[model samples]
Target: MEFFPYDVKELFKQIESKPNLWNRSAHEYRNKEAREHDWKAIYTHFEPNFDKMNRLDQKEIGECIMTKWNYIRASFMRTVKHGPPTRRPYVYYDHLKFLLKSDVKAIDAPHLDNNDDTLEQIPEKKLKVSPFLDEDTEIF
Candidate 1:
């Protein structure tokens, strides 16, 4: 015996009693009636657009289209080898400002080959710096 949240028999009985009203706005009714329709009926659907200038092979053309669409679907539009790249979408700065601040990297810190005091190498000389003083000058 299988279990369902709603009674299947009762739902069907309700459908038999009073048919549901036609909801024109409903997405469920859209292009659904012809879902099982033959795709080849659409002319543009089979057109070789990927290799426009090159001599197209029928097998390669279909494979290219299928790969873009269905073959190993998880990778979608991206090639599997170029696995989902690390992208910083929402940035604190604008694209131009971000490019200007590209020198600062979180983990790309300057390292010394010698296992010496990297911090002590810097002379403790206090200097007052202000962005308002010189806009052209870059801070280290």
Candidate 2:
């Protein structure tokens, strides 16, 4: 609702009469009352100039000129993002980054519990050592 102040109508008149009005930077339009009163006139001249701003660098002069406009644009962007956002459930699963499903299954197979066959494949403990005594040195 708020905007910067500039003498657009007077300048427009000056241009109409003099035919050689000097172009000024958008920063010069920092009059609060004038902006509130003559926003339509100001926008009529300035809005088209918005398209010319392809890069952020274009807006950034020495001391941040278009504060209100920038704030409104940022607020609008935060409220209504353009698209569904650049997001993906899975980014990349190339062979170099991770092994295939089959390879993973094979690698994990040894750790997983299987039927009787796999249990039987495990070596059973043949000895249980007493905590007090060493197996290599017997008590004589």
Candidate 3:
């Protein structure tokens, strides 16, 4: 669970070298094309925008990377705790980067408050339900 700060950078380099680490059938079919497209999009999105991002935004992205790095490390720990896979190296670093980048936007989300709740409180609806419910009903 202890992720070094450079882990993400190392992962990016590894992913660039070995883009098809997962080796799914879908990857065999389309990964080359898809990976190119994904890389292009990532570059387009991040390259020019890098300088525009504030220090806070960069910090948020770093936090996201750390969070996902720890999560993947924890998963690896669990995998080892249970048993080794028939194959070695069950997860790839790119998988962790993918997870981190996917969630990075949420970490960088702006804290603007919409005016919906400024004037008045929205009424809460009360649902009538029996405290003791048999196994038939689902709460959700």
Candidate 4:
């Protein structure tokens, strides 16, 4: 079954219930088994309509959901890193504002900041004059 915009919104709602799918700091997000379990929960939510033809397998459904999630995430990150574009933001932008909580930390993360130490120059060693060296010798 083709997912309409509303269906996608419902999917996001389901994702909201499962932090592993969106919250990176969640322990489940780092655990492969836990993540797969959460994915199963997400895919199951759409089983009724999605499996009407029994054409889509669990993996396919998971991929489709993840693809949508990735697109929305990328769009959100863009708006966060840069300002909103001339066009309006994604339809679900407001619904996904929860992302800002995590993204704000990432935006202000230390790695993104410029360090003063990196700008400091190391002292150069001075060359000593050798008494035995010929004056005619060209350093170049």
List CA RMSD, all candidates.
24.6, 26.1, 17.0, 11.7
Task: Give the lDDT of residue 66 in candidate 2.
Answer: 38
- For residues 29-116, what per-residue lDDT tens digits would candidate 3 score against the true structure? 3557765554444333434474467878755654555466456556644443344455464455334434332222222212212242
Q: Against the true structure, candidate 3 has what lDDT?
A: 0.45
In angstroms, the error of model 3 at 20 is 27
lDDT of 1: 0.31
Q: Kindly list the per-residue Cα lDDT of model 1 for residues 3-62, writing each as its tens digit.
A: 333333332232222211112233442454432122222212355253353445645544
Model 4, residue 16: displacement in angstroms?
Answer: 1.1
Clashes of each: 0, 1, 0, 0
Better of 3 and 4 by TM-score: 4
Worst 10 residues of 2 by lDDT: 93-102
Q: Taking the tens digit of each residue's C-alpha lDDT, what string does model 2 give over 9-125?
A: 333342233211111222323555544334433343544464365556434421133354344334333322232134321222111111121122223223223452222233333
- In order, the Cα lDDT scores of the candidates are 0.31, 0.34, 0.45, 0.65
Tell how far residue 133 is off in model 1, in angstroms: 68
Positional deviation of residue 23's Cα in model 2 after best superposition, in angstroms: 24
Question: How does model 1 score by TM-score?
Answer: 0.20
Candidate 4 weakest ten by summed lDDT: 111-120
